[model samples]
Target: MKTGAGIREHGATVIVAALSTLFASTLILGTGVMTAALDPDLIESSGTFRMVLLMVSAVFIVIALYVGAIVTANTFATIIAGRTRTIALLRLVGASSRKVRSRVAGEGLLMGALGAGIGWVLAELLILAAVTWGPGLGWLPAGREYPRFDPLTVGAVGVVALTTWAAAWAGSRRVGSVSPIAATGAAVELRPDAARGRTARTVWSIILIILGAVFLTLGLLLGMLTPLALLVAFFGGLLSFTGIALGAHIIMPPILRLTGTLLGQGPTGRLAAANAVRFPERSARSTIGLVIGVTLVTMFAVALETYGSMTQIAFESDPALAAALAETLAITTAVFTGLVGFSAIIAAVGMVNTLSLSVLQRTRELGLLRALGFTGGQVRRMVIAESCQMTLAALGFGLLLGVFYGWVAAQSLLGSQAGFAPPTIPWLVVSGIVVFGFILAVSAAVAPARRAIRVSPVAALAVD
Candidate 1:
């Protein structure tokens, strides 16, 4: 029953589990492909193939592990939040806190195993289909054979399964914090303390930004690929990403207000802004996914644009070479950016879950609005407003981080090479992402808004 409830209610979260497994499977497949292509040459040269294989596998493992950990952690947090009522009931019925936590963990284990298995199967099926139709589909070189299975597939499943368990175990502790009668009593939204949130964000943001600045300064000053410079450049990039994420929340409310003021001028727009800020936690949480995805995508886009411009300027005497370099770079950048763009899938799923959960939490409030003669359209508009506010917050911060990170990457990697023109940003991709973010924001609200507007005011009030 517990497993079924989780699967039924938290379908979006489950998709994360599956995607984790898929990524892992892809990693395994990737190494296997490399092994097939590289083994014969390495063997002829008298090099040890096993070590090379291990190195390749290790890189993919780290990437898959990182992706799995974050996805599962965020997902399980959502699941735990939504299950507050059921957990409270379990506790009230003499279930020990340990027992409650164990149950949640067990449920997560079941979910993890299921998702891993399903993802592995789906990935294998995709591989098979790709192999069979790859030539026609243009996924591979013409007449190339399908990739063979690798032994590491089992390990990939294990990796994702373990990640899910760890995330679930960590997030389930929240179950113990809620009172047994949490649902019976008035709903006490568990929010991080606002002052502390702001203060911590501010301090951390400044620290990271400074750290990143130091790295850039040192890299620019020393202008070498030494250990210190590499460390500075790498850490600078990481620190900038971290700082932006932390500081985003601090700046969110103001950005949201500005976005709301600019985009929404009517009564509905005002209501949307008011509703969004009213629940600071929800609004803030909803933006996390968009921020990361948009940031990475925009960051790469900017870096490529800058590089292309530099090449063009450097080779202006030979327009053919300049155009060729720019075209090649554009294609390469698009491919790389597309890979990173997968981060948005998590954001979209989180947005939908957040919005749905929000709707569920405010059933009676929405009904009250309807009862007070506010039309259903008005309620819908309010939800749309909330989405817009979150979207705006995401874009403001995402673009900011993208610009800084992209410039840092360009300078760090290409700065030593003389005769390159200054960095140039292509705003077109950023503009598209804004529209994409907006659409994602609005689309996420559809089902939730429908659920909210359908509840009759009198019925909702009575039930509450």
Candidate 2:
């Protein structure tokens, strides 16, 4: 029965998973090719460079998978919300919630496998093309041949598939809360009160945040002795960020309300603000991806800037060492930025998918609004306003988190060498982030707004 929904419904999920795997595999293979081209004998002479390359590739792959998982989980959650009535009917007909959830998760596993397979094939073909013709085209060194296949590619595919399956299972958790009695009512999302009542999640979120703070502080103190303190800070950042994601519904509404005021008190603006606050879970899911992307970009920028400041102070007496440090910082910044771009793309796709699904599910409500004398332009403005509001809130929150995390990272890593220093704000990156948010807000809203306004009042009202 679920398969009858057709591939179009799951296209977003597949695209996200496929892109993620493709990026990971490409990085792994590309890194090997580049290493070979640059230093074919380095592996035989010294394993240190090889290990560094491997670690760099691993960092990129991990980031890609993390972004993919969050996007996948959010997509599945939105899909399940739309299937509330159908799921309730199954429960009414004697299907246990666990059984239903398992089925959904099984579907996710199949989809993940399909996406991973497609990505693997594409990655291989891409590398083959690059290896065969890159040297001839001067894209590679003139006298070197690069290996087109890596056994690691297979591992990348498997990892992505498993991650997607896990995300799907986590997303389908809401299935357990759907009572059989709900089958008799019109399809609807969880109400604000119900969303707020998840006591266990709230408790866990607070616990993680507190523990993460302690670890981050400890990482700073321990950093005075060894650079390995970064490992501790890394876990702290992960735990705290996960807590933030888990508690987004509780954390985002007030920010949304505050940002909504910037949209003015016009009717369309008010409607948009109300809609966002009315569905805290949906709003949080929609904006969390953007938050992550913005946060990473800001964190890296601030961290690198702070590191540069500390290094300049520490190495002022050694011109050659300072010059080399500057070059290394430039290369590191470029690499991290490129890797973060993949995450941003994934986040953008998720936002578009979420917005479109929200509109689809609210068809009846849209129709009622149209019938009550709202113009199509007004509807469009309302959606765009909502998008802008969410983006604004995410931007503000991400900047704060980014600066704090970035400062912690730099201080933890370099406190012993140069002592504590103030975080250097990268105004350029912040400006770029603001501009990107504006563009994203408008672009993400276009299709969803168009769909919302196209709903025929009479026909939409007749839908269940």
Candidate 3:
């Protein structure tokens, strides 16, 4: 009974993780295919800073999604390792490792199949709807909505399923290592590896950071971003963040103290700052995904801004439509910005929760605080504060980039009108978007923080 329970638990994790990964990947891939088909020129020759930003951001979105999926798969693999004893017991009781592996793999395959089917059905429904509405709308391209299913999509789904199963199979090596006597004992403890990486890893990290910054800068400057350049920048930025985290680990204490001076923070804020600054690996991984997501969100903001500004220019030339331009631009920006921003928020929230889950799982010590008058509300508030701080920092960087890109795009469109004059921003509009994002981030943090608070004090003290 226990063995079945353990299998079921790990299996569920694998399935959920796999489904998420596949869905994200499909979106990325499908978007690319659609863009290439719809806007070949934009994908090719038009090398503007904003265009480069769009292309690079799209590529990064795909990379981040795939990387996240792999990480989830790895975690699922590790969890399966935790159940090695159960596997060994089954092996000793006349099951082959191959058979045990099959069961694990089969569970993932089943989930993958279901997820892929659902995705396909959704795609087909969308395609059908597009086809049906295409002519009546007059806004859509003729027959453009008819989405044909390619064998490649099916192959891609198969690859996702296979990759997931392979991860489980590889992790099952721990099963072979387990003693059959594990059936009578507690699960073996696997210590977290020490904070050590090789010289090669450090060198690679530095190289990647440098290269990523260069490609990202160049892509923005040249306005002609290729997929290759975006891929390099994506991986490079990821490695760079890893290096930053490692370096931060050494400097965090002093840095935290210095930052506290700037904030003039109270005890609660200070603690939050210390917690985030002190833990380099946690902070880096937690925020890295957000950085990627926010970077894309920011770039998309610039693209939409540029597009709207140009559309407004065209509208301004039309004396009859001049009055309508503001309303149209307002509506378009609202819709596009909301879509792009919400996607980033989802990614950011996921990353934040991933880190929060790890923290809550490890820090049973915090449960004692819940007993010491730290209401669940207070605890939740603290966790959210950390997320909000990181998000705001990201938002600042994004806004700066957006300003630059928006200016360049505006100049390109309204060449003569563009001068040394300072660009006027729609402050109220920008503020509304920022406020909406903050509200969403805060709302998302609530459930996880509450879960942390609810852990019993007994559980807190029991941690090693």
Candidate 4:
């Protein structure tokens, strides 16, 4: 009767799902209302202003979709992996594979409904907070009234709910594929075959790369900085980032081990490194969301800087309009960048889930290390090293991809109008994110490390 309770036990997935939906839905509703308030007819009368607004809105939506999909899929996958035992138990007790899939889907649908509702409420509160406090904080211009509740909000919630359900369903596909025998083994047969076809994956990666390049090239052909052109460019960048991410997954095993080697001087590093690549699929799940998020972050940061500099040069004669335009663009840039960055928070949540499970799964191994005279401090360091290696590797690759995309955006958008603004590196912000990321990585390990530490070495070694 209660076989489906495994997913329910993990509140983290539910929470992340809710937040993902809320972030996207709220932005959608807010934008629609705001746009409705600013009649398109009037904005259309102004040449590029409407385009700028539309392009910004489109960017937010794209980030939301990308981040939401990755985050939701990872979260649900974590839930299913953790519940492999329950699934196997159900199978042994006569539950059909179809039934197992149904249970998982049902859980997803329930969570989706609940998450969407909560997201809607959160979005409402966010909009309310903005309306009440935005002007006071100088984030909103004076006399811009908050738009009233729009029916589109409901549609936004529905869209997110559907997205959550799809992600959950997709995540659970392998759940039913596991044989009842695996329940005793504490491992899911993630490696489906004795060997995988490298050719198929390679071909897929190549196709995506070509597709992304086409999008980017098309963006350039569309126009410079126009709404249509930037929208096209954003998609191009997104596709390219996705292609790179897939390629990264294929190479992560080597990269992780190499980075792990650099993380420290001895056996500890090797252990941590081996743990990372021990399950490349698992590691990929943990990092892909952040990879996408950070790549977008870098791309937009450079694009905005380039765009702002061009605006300065283009409108040098009229200081008033120039100042107003510059100010508006800056605000828009910060906001969209923030929206894109939210993807990383979800990734961080995935890290928490993944690392916690890693610790739980390795209880016996950690105990043996402790029994071998490894101090509690050393135990802590080992986990911390693993976290750092993962975080740094993900961010490093993301940074390079972002830089490349940002450069492309700046050149295509501003190249003809003005010579490319020297690559606008938002060093302070990037540095801040790196610091925050390390702190988060360290934080994720604390609970697991403490849990691992509390058990007597004998008991830990005895844990099944």
Residue-pair clashes per candidate? 0, 0, 2, 0
After the best TM-score superposition of candidate 2, give how far the Cα of residue 297 lies from its true spot, in angstroms: 1.6
lDDT of 3 by residue, 1-464 (tens): 35754443444334434444444444444443354345445645433533554554555434443443433343444444345557767867888767776776676566555555555555555555645675578645454433445454465556555655564565344455566767654334333132233345456656665765665464433333222333433444455444543343232334334443443376557666666555444444355445444544554555455545655565566766755766776686675565455445445544544444544444454676666776666666667776666556545544554555444444333433322223445565457547755675576466667766667767765643
Worst 10 residues of 3 by lDDT: 189-198
**lDDT, each prediction:** 0.67, 0.85, 0.51, 0.70
lDDT tens digits, residue span 354-443, model 2: 877777778788889999999999988988999999999999999999999998899889888888789988898889989988899899
Tell me the TM-score of model 2. Answer: 0.95
Q: Could you tell me every candidate's TM-score relative to the true structure? A: 0.82, 0.95, 0.58, 0.83
lDDT of 1 by residue, 1-464 (tens): 35654454457556766776776676566545544444344646423454575665564455445444544555555566666676677778888877877876776677778878888888788766766676577655464344657667778777677777786787566667777878564333445355335575589888997887787777655543432454466677777666755565455666677777765577677878876666454565567667777777887888778767656665788999888887899788876666566555655666666667667667777888888888998889788877877788788888887887776666655555434345577777888898888888888887788877887888877643
Evaluation by lDDT, superior candidate among 3 and 4: 4
- List runs of model 2 lying over 4 Å from the truth: 1-8, 40-43, 46-48
Error of 3 at 3 (Å): 12
Order of quality (lDDT)? 2, 4, 1, 3
